[model samples]
Target: MMRIVVTGANGFIGRKLVRALLDQPSLSGADGAPVPLSDLRLFDVVPPEVPAGAADGPVTVRCMAGDLSDPAALGAVMNGGVDVVFHLAAVVSAQAEEDFGLGMRVNFDATRALLDACRQSAPDGAARLVFTSSVAVFGGDLPEVVRDDTAPVPQSSYGVQKAMGELLVQDYARRGFVDGRTVRLPTIVVRPGPPNKAASTFASSIIREPLNGEDAVCPVPAETGLFVSSPRRIVANLIQAATLPAARFGRDRTVMLPGLSVTVAEMIKALRAEAGDGAVARIRFQDDPRVRAIVASWPARFETARATALGFQADASFAEVIRAFVEDEMGAPHKDPVS
Candidate 1:
C-alpha cells in the first residue's frame, strides 16, 4: 500500500489535487508500475479540509496542521513511513516580494527542511517526491520560445526562491536521496475564488469576477501576453507526472508543462464569446505598473516538447477555460468527469 503526504493540502490547487487522488487512489512508482494508495496525509499551516467523499473511499485521509517552519511540526509531517511526497506549499509572487523575510522562511527554508526530513526518514526506500515550481523561474532576457533546456534568470524574490528549490531537488535526486521530479507550471487562469497575493492574480479576476456577476479590473494592457492553463489541465498533469516511468525524466527530472500562449485582448474576446456583451462590458481596464512589471518579466511562450512527450497537456482554448469554471463551480447541471 502507498502512503503519501501532500503539503499545502488546503490551498486551491491542493484541494483539487486531494479530490482527484481520492477518486483515483493510486500513483506511479519509479518502475512505471501501479502503486495502490491506501493512506493520505494532508499537511498545511492551517487545518486542511478533508475531501468530502474521503470517508467512503478506499484511502485513509488525515489532516495535519501546524507551522512547517518548526522542526517538531516538520518531523511529524514525515513521521509515518511515506512512499511519496507532494510539496505544494509556497508564498505567492507579490506576497513574497512584499515580505522578503516571510517568503524566505516559508518558500526557501521550509522546502529545504522538508527535503531533509525525507532524506532522514524513508527507511523502506527513496520516496517519490514532486516539487511544484513556476514559470517565474525564468525571467530577464529570454529567447522567443523558452525551452526545457533554457537557463533560469529569476527577476523576482519569489522566482529566485523557487529557482533555489528546483536546484536543491535536482541535486538531492542526483545523490539518490529521493526519487525527485519538478514541474514548472504556468499562470493558472479562471480560478473560482477571490484573488490572492500572486502578481498574476488579475489574469484570473478579469475572467472570474465578471462571470460571477461582479465587475473586474484588468491591470495590464490588452496586448499584454500571458502563458496560462486551466485548473483541469494542471491537476491532470500533476497526477500524470507520478505515473510516468522515472527513466523518462532522465537526469534533469524537470518538465516545463505546456500552456496556451494568449494575449489579454484575446482572453476578453473569448470571455465575451462565452458570456456575451454584458460580461465583456463588466471588465474595466486600469493600468497598474507594479502588476505589469512582474507579469511582463515572465515569458509568455514556451516550447514544452518534453512535457508533451511525457503525456502532459494544455487547455484547448481560453473559451474552454471559462466554460470549465461555469460547469465546475457555477452550478451547471452536468459536470465534466474526472480526467
Candidate 2:
C-alpha cells in the first residue's frame, strides 16, 4: 500500500482530502480508483476529526501535530516511507500581509524545507509532491482574462511567497528529486468555516452569513469581479493533480485551474435566488480600502485552456456553486433570498 502524507490535515481542504484518502480502497491504482483509509499519514497543526466508524477496522492512521516550519519536526514525519505529499499548509493572503515574516517562514521557507526533506527521504526518488498555490500569484497589471502563459506579478507578500514556492517545486522536479506539480487554485468560495483572514473571506461570508441568519458586508462594489471555485471542486482538482498522467502535463511545472468568474452583484443575486429576498437583505455593501485595493489587484477572470485540456473541471455557474454549498455545507432547505 502506498503511504500518503498530507500537511494541513486539520484545515478545510486538508480535512476533506484526508477523509477522501482514508476512504480510498487499497490495491487500487492511482488512476484506477480511490484508495482505502488504511494507507494514510495525516499531519497538521491540530489533529483532524476522523469519522466515528473509522476505528472499527484494521486501518493504519498516523496523526502528527507540530510546527511544519521546523526542520526536525518535518524530518520526523518524513522519516517513514512516503509515496505522496500534499502541501496545503500556509498563511492566507490578508494574514500573510499583516505579518510578512510569518508568511515567508511558513509559506516559502517551510515549503522549501518540506521539499528538501522529501528529496532526502526518497534516496531512489520515489514520491509525488503536490503543492497548492493560489491565484494571488497574479496581480498588479493583469489582463481581463489571465491565460495559462501569463507571467505572475504578485502584489502581496502572500502571493510572493506562493510564487516562490512554485519556483522551488519546479526546481525540485527538474532535479528529479520529486515528481512535483504546482496548482494555482482560485479563491474557494462558500468555504465551510468561520471567516478566515483571507481578503477573499467575503466570498464565503455572503453565503454563510445568510445561512446563519446574519448579515454580511460586501467590501467591494457590485461590479467587482473575481475568480472562485467551491471547496469540493478544489479538493477534486488537487486529487487529480496527484493521479493524472505526467505525459499530459508535458514540461509545464505549474497549471492554472479553471474557475467561474463572477461579480459581487452576481454572487448576491445567486444567493438571493436560492435563499430568498430576505437573505439578500442580509447583505449590505461596506467598502474597506485595504481589502478593496487588494481584491482589485487580483485577476477577475482566467483563460485556463491548459487545465481544461488536461480534463480538470469547474462549477458551471455561481448559482450552481451556491446550490452545492447549500446542499453540501449548509444542510438546510434551499431558501430563496428575500428581495
> Looking at model 2, which ten-residue stretch has the lowest summed lDDT?
21-30
Q: Name the best candidate (by TM-score).
A: 1
State the lDDT of candidate 2 residue by residue for 147-226, as single tens digits. 99899999889889999999998888877887788999998888887887777899899888987789888888899898
At residue 188, candidate 2 shows an lDDT of 87
Which residue pairs come into collision in candidate 1?
A: none
TM-score of 2: 0.91
Query: Which stretches of model 1 miss by more than 4 angstroms?
Result: 123-125, 334-338
The weakest ten consecutive residues by lDDT in model 1 span: 330-339
lDDT of each: 0.86, 0.82
Per-residue lDDT of model 1, residues 1-339, tens digit only = 888999999988999889888887878765667788988999998989778878878898889998778899988878877888888998888789899998999898998888888887874337878889999898888998899899999888988998898888888888877777889998898788888777788899998888887999888999999999988788888887766766778888788999999999999999999898998899999999998987787899899999999889998888888887887678875455533
